[model samples]
Target chain A: MPALKKKITKPPTAARMVEDIIGCKWSLTVLSLVRSGVKRPGAMQRRVEGLTAKVLNERLRKLLRYEIIEREVFAEVPPRVEYRLTEFGNRFGAVIDQITALDEERS
Target chain B: MPALKKKITKPPTAARMVEDIIGCKWSLTVLSLVRSGVKRPGAMQRRVEGLTAKVLNERLRKLLRYEIIEREVFAEVPPRVEYRLTEFGNRFGAVIDQITALDEERS
Candidate 1:
């Protein structure tokens, strides 16, 4: 007889994804910077004080994993990488903007 | 002379509050249960598997701290406590409903 199994891990939902994305203060800050057209990693690192390259890379990877942001590589002698929100991310950003406004109102 | 102090904590914004509230799997589950009419603590605890009284109390306290939910006590032999969403929470709930629909679509 086959052994019975129970799945303990549930797939992350949209809400869960949002929670995960914004749970970190740095991730939230990074998302805002990316939304405001600060695209390159180096630029983002410079823009946010105390944000190290390693941590920024991890945050960027997470954003990419969740389809919140996408990267573009330009063909050049020195390659240029830039980040932008996907369509879904744009929609998510709209919700975030609402939250920002709500924050302004409440705080 | 008084020692110079550096403020280490950021006052939680509305977005931060939402992030904190939904960051925990159990907290998100409890919030949903409360939103769906699971008012009493005992009932909420029974409704969610693996939710203990201690954890439920903690989540409830966090919710009350954020002003997301308010509690009412009734006079009886056994005092009855009920939880309900505040006006701000209702607005927050509208955003939550949007996220629920989004989650249903994405997941």
Candidate 2:
């Protein structure tokens, strides 16, 4: 019998996951707004400019699924909701800080 | 005359640039390979698996435009061309490290 070659498989890498999350349109914009203190959906929309509410909601849901951000719903007449970064999400700050430093270096 | 609302302009931020570069398909994969010591195009294509040469060239050109990676040409019989991360590109290590840490933490 002939020897069979082992097939190589590439699992979803952490870098790939990170790339997918940020690859979506407005994903980074939404994350940036949330990190900059704009937690409410309405606030993010206003700050981002041109990001439709539908897209914002989609990104928020995806971010939640990835455990990047957490959403809190308050029991109120209007059902207030706020989004914040989780511990894992906060770790992304280091990446953002490095990017900011690079930008500063360029400008 | 009625007062006019100041037009808000959001200049491209460093974080946005970083997102743009990494958002492209195979961008991170190529960078990861290079950072892992696979600096040749042929080696990168082989290691990344499924990345077409055309796409790799495009991503490399974009990365060059962003000043993320620098190219070196060696005078040899085959005219070897190699790519390596620039100082700015090396800074992306922080982001990748954070992502790796997050992945490890999750697992």
Candidate 3:
């Protein structure tokens, strides 16, 4: 078996953590759409122009791995699977709002 | 000559702009160090662990292109060059602070 990667004892700097979360292509766009209530994967793909399903899935998986978002599965007729921001994710939303405000201030 | 990319500009969304600014490797770390008064390029590279001069220069160029940081040159014995955040850059700092705070809150 391949050797497991060493566990990181030192937590990353907050800026580094935030950068990792947002650095991937489509990550921020996916988060923004989720914050705006586009929770379903199909909806998110439709909302973010030019974002392919494959790319969206990748972004969503990353966000899930980071614990920034949570996935809920329902046993309904259509078997719904939806995503929502975790508490941490909501906190991130606040940061995004601040960034948006900064951009507006400059413009 | 290769066709120039068309520039029919409908400006990007605020979230997209913010992501573009922070998405690159070492971009946020460099920005954070600069905001914290590590103004000189050499100083910044020294301060942010694992940041090479080449990577730092690339990030600096991108920041300059975005008008997020301004470069100043002084004609001294060795010719000093330093970077300072623009008005917009300071605004970005506030956003970074918010992200930092959010991280702290969760931890």
Candidate 4:
């Protein structure tokens, strides 16, 4: 088994955390889409434009794991499923918006 | 040759651009380190803590390509080299700072 690194005086910094969140392209885009209410998996797949089913599914699972986005499943013939931003996700969305605004300034 | 897709009415959004920057773990962390004074290749390798030499070199090359950071090479026996963020990089850093601040709020 792989040993876990001991926690030192300081844990990983906030900067590093942000780096991880933004490091995965699908996560960033998926989060943005969820914030915009592209709740259905198919709709979200359409909204992000270039992501393949494999990658989108992977990202969604990770987001669910992170609790940034909540996934809901309904009992129906087709099994309706939806995703929405959690409160934590909203805060993250605000930060992403700021980054978008800055990129706009550059353009 | 892969055919270039025609430019649509809307180009890729600013959010998409930010997504690309943050999507790569190395690029995001590299920009953060360069914003600090860890400019030399060896020093940067140490400060980032876990990146291999190959990845660091790759990220540095990409940053240089983006013109977000400028590289300075001194003519000397050991060939001293350094990197500094350009104005564009400084603006990018500000956006990163906001993201970092948001992460802190959550923590």
Candidate 5:
């Protein structure tokens, strides 16, 4: 019984979680945009050719949940919301930078 | 027409290619094992908790296609085959190492 349980149960590893976050093509594009200083939702949609509002929101929510990125809402006449990487997220981005570096190094 | 075509066609970037490779959870596990020096396919199947021979072979073939890992066959009576990372693959591993580092740094 113990052996079966051990075989069946694998913890949600940080690495696995990271992999899940980056696996989606849209997620990778979103993260890349955010990393490259495209912060607001509108700008992100514009920068990347076909990123729609619905999908962008979904990815943003997922990124927020992972603590890889954060959202900030302003108190102006029209509330301007922006997203940016958290401290841990910035560190996470550095790892992703390695992926970007992989292409550069090889090229 | 050119603008429409440009919007519709996004070139396959190297980073995206790398993402597609690591996107497989099993691939990540297999690469982790290979990086840790577990070389043989049979040994790899035994080492991971629930990895089936079929799935492992599928992953191995995919990794080989991406040129991430290579296989070698010995000339002994009982042929011995072992897999190792290529030069490009070792560099790819370094990006993966950054991900492993992310967990360690936070913990």
Candidate 6:
């Protein structure tokens, strides 16, 4: 006789994904800026507007850790730094952009 | 001469909206459940899986406060309670569903 089997199930919804996406305060903002072509960290801060220096730095670090953004350092005087969205991050950005567009259209 | 007016600018992105949507840990979960047609508060708790009674109650209150969900108390024995998504909440739920669909497609 075959052994009785138990089926493992997964949550039908994307609660985990939603949780991961909105876990950070500045994630969406950072993604938006990166999508808008602000690759430099300094410029990202400027584009986000109203984000404090400390918060911006922390968010950038978090984004880097999450692999949502990549950091590249130039081998030059003063070390030019650039941050760009990874493929995954770009996909997330597209979702955010669509949501933002829908939200704006409602206004 | 017209005064050189300062542009009272608004944040170009939806930081506040994102913040508002994810402000509560259970907002997304609750919205998901409501969209799936689990209306009663008790049933909502059951559908979310892993949410505690306390958390579910608190989340329900928060969802009510945010106007994302509506509460209707039926005039009956023992007081029947039901919850439903407002129109705005339905729109938000559609976005969430789309995101969830995308996430699932990636798997």
**Which pairs of residues collide in candidate 5?**
none
RMSD of every candidate to native, in Å, equals: 6.8, 11.0, 7.2, 9.7, 9.1, 12.0
Question: What stretches of model 4 exceed 4 Å from their correct place?
Answer: A1-101, A104-107, B1-14, B103-107
Cα lDDT computed for each candidate against the true fold: 0.80, 0.74, 0.76, 0.74, 0.77, 0.67
TM-score of each: 0.58, 0.52, 0.51, 0.45, 0.54, 0.48
Pick by TM-score: which candidate is best? Answer: 1
Q: Which ten residues in a row have the lowest lDDT in candidate 2 chain A?
A: A10-19
Candidate 6 lDDT by residue in tens digits, A1-107: 99889897653223343444555657667766777778887776666668877887787886676556799999989899998888766666666655566556556
Residue B54 displacement in candidate 5 (angstroms):
13
Which DockQ-derived CAPRI band holds candidate 4? incorrect
Per-prediction DockQ: 0.30, 0.25, 0.29, 0.21, 0.23, 0.12
lDDT tens digits, residue span A1-107, model 1: 89889778664666666666656888888888888889999999889899999899999998887778999999987999999988777778777766667666666
Name the candidate that leads on DockQ. 1
Q: For model 1, how does the per-residue alpha-carbon lDDT over B10-106 read when each residue is reduced to its tens digit?
A: 5566656665665587778878888888899999977888999999999889888778889999998799999998877777767766666666666
Task: Report how far residue A68 has shifted in candidate 2, in Å.
Answer: 1.1
Candidate whose lDDT is highest: 1
| Positional deviation of residue B88's Cα in model 3 after best superposition, in angstroms | 4.2
Tens-digit per-residue lDDT, A1-107, candidate 4: 99999966544343453445666777788887887788898887777678888988898887776567898899998899999998876766676666556556667
Residue B34 displacement (Å), model 5: 5.9
TM-score of 3: 0.51
- Candidate 1 runs further than 4 Å off: A1-11, A99-107, B1-66, B69-85
